[model samples]
Target: MSGRLSMCTICPGENEQIDAVIKIGRERRSVIYGTVIDENRDPVADAVVKLLQVCDNGRIIPLTHTFTDKYGQFLLGPLCPNQKYMLKIYKDNITIRYDPIDAECSDGDCIGNKCKRHDSGCK
Candidate 1:
């Protein structure tokens, strides 16, 4: 009893809560990850993945953008937790059809906590 040792194993107590517990943030992150595919389901490298912010009244604003890797895989964010966003793909008309993800959805996952919300391209 000399040394203080405590095992704080945080389990959701069931399978359903696994994802819930893992994503323990005030605002659950909007993590959008996928491969840029062409019409034939082939990986397209250097494709653009655009993340646009939506206004309170459902207005689309221009946000930052990124390019997919050689594997056609791209990581949109570590974006604002529990925030709404519009994700789009460019350079080949790659329409992104994924649910918005944020920065708080993992117990030990490494994601940026920075609020990279740019005020540019706002109308």
Candidate 2:
């Protein structure tokens, strides 16, 4: 009876399969395409990009906006889970403004084309 009680109370290693399982069960990280360019497909730095979450009513509500880096790379979320979104890119001189692009969603996350979702947008 004593041995049974001790075994029942004893805990396994803290760094074992349990930890790995928990980690795996956690939400997977999301990614987005991150590059904008001119007509020649060359990197266009310092461009502004706007991000919006698409509602069921088809309304375009602004979420956030970011500027492209020297490499013309930008990132958006972690945005709303299981929601569609759109992205718009703008350059003052090099080219005309771009229409918003539809964000592709997988799992509970979203990826902005040429954009990275925020690291903590998921809830």
How do all models score by TM-score? 0.49, 0.52
For candidate 2, lDDT tens digit of each residue in 1-123? 011111123367867554322122344334345899898999999998998878899898998899999999987656545678888888877467789987664445345545455555444
User: Which residue pairs collide, candidate 1?
Assistant: 29-101, 29-102, 29-103, 29-104, 30-101, 30-102, 31-101, 31-102
Residue lDDT tens for model 1, 18-68: 543333325344567889888898898988899998888988997788999
lDDT of 1: 0.71
Best by lDDT: 1
* Top-TM-score structure, candidate number: 2
Computed on alpha carbons, the lDDT of every model, listed in order, comes to: 0.71, 0.69
lDDT of 2: 0.69
Q: Point out the worst 10-residue segment of candidate 2 by lDDT.
A: 1-10
Task: Give the C-alpha miss distance for residue 24 in model 1, angstroms.
Answer: 11
